[model samples]
Target: MTALHWKLVIDAADPHAQADFWARALGYTVEDNGAFIERLLAAGHAPAELTVEAHGRRAWRDLAAVRHPDDPYEEATGIGHGRRLLFQRVPEAKTAKNRLHIDVHAGPARDRAAEVARLESLGASVLRDVDEPGGRWTVMADPEGNEFCVQ
Candidate 1:
């Protein structure tokens, strides 16, 4: 049997932009594929049209990804093999609510209000506040309207 690895794939209008936002929001680092991309291009294996200048380096035009700082990554490719979120460029804009969303646990040692405020400062907009018997959480949307919760 083969091992299976997975990453959360998101659709975005501007993949690099979304990657940047989520990277800061989650305290993750954007995967740098500059060396690998350059190798592919220079070797005539990949077309220049598939790449773009992002973060002052070459990146896939349709894809960008972020990963936890502590995770292991391929040194040659700068690709994280664990706990990664990949944003891929989509042709259409988001027109409906997300069927699945991310829930952020700010931790029992952390202040919920402070965490929510911090996320807002990073470009998340509060959709609403929810207070229930179970616990309290804030519904928020990212820059491109992807919804998530903060608790």
Candidate 2:
């Protein structure tokens, strides 16, 4: 048996914006993909309409991604080989709660409240605070209303 490689793909109205937000929030790196895009364009395989300038480089207009900084990636294409999140543009709006969510753990050395405040500063809104015998966590929504937790 072999393990498969995969990335978490999110639907968003603005994939580039989502990538930027997640990259900063998670201390990750935005995948460049500029060189690959350029090659595709030069080879007449991709149209210019499908690309946009991001971070001063070419990127897929409807797709963007962020990856853990320490993870392995393909240098030529700037595609992450591990721990990646891909955001793709979608026409429809999010109308329901997410079935799955991310939980950000504030390690014992870090202050949870401060972390929550920092996330709020980055366009996240606090939904509510949970204090239970199991543990305490703060539910929050991102700029696009995706719910996640800060523990």
Candidate 3:
């Protein structure tokens, strides 16, 4: 079969921290590729400089990922099959607003007001609230300033 997968790769100053924050915020599980790392190290395929001790375990410092809680994951590697967000280390800060953004659909049952309140409690700040003829939504920024919408 042809390869087909969807993942969002985010550039972060601290990939592990980002992964941790996202894992908590989205109720996701952080991927633990420690087994693969150990295998590479044992085989001399991974350079010492590429590894670091994080959370008392060997991890790749440059990249980490978090996946949705209900998604199917590989137990050995802790990689998931669906709705994954990969965070990769970068040296620079986010200089501008995102050209693309994520929207969290809390559903009409929750109502926008309650959802916004809940998100605020989870460390999100309201950026703006829009009311249009078709519909309305509230824009919010995550702890690291990534923008998302609640509708």
Best by TM-score: 2
lDDT by residue (tens digit), candidate 1, 54-148: 99999999999999999999999999989999999999999999998989989989998999899999889999999999989999999999999
What tens digits encode model 2's per-residue C-alpha lDDT throughout 1-151? 8999999999999999889988888999999999999999999999999999999999999999999999999999999999999999999999999998889988899999999998999899999999999999999998899999999
Model 3: per-residue Cα lDDT at residue 11: 87
Candidate order by lDDT, decreasing, is 1, 2, 3
Which one wins on lDDT? 1
lDDT of 3 by residue, 57-101 (tens): 889989989999888988877778899999898888888999888
| Structural similarity to truth (TM-score) of each candidate | 0.95, 0.98, 0.85
Model 3 poorest ten-residue lDDT run: 18-27
Error of 2 at 107 (Å): 0.9
Query: Against the hidden true structure, what lDDT does model 1 obtain?
Result: 0.95
Can you rank all candidates by TM-score, best first?
2, 1, 3
- How high is the lDDT of residue 81 in model 1? 89
What would the C-alpha RMSD of candidate 1 be, to one decimal place? 1.2
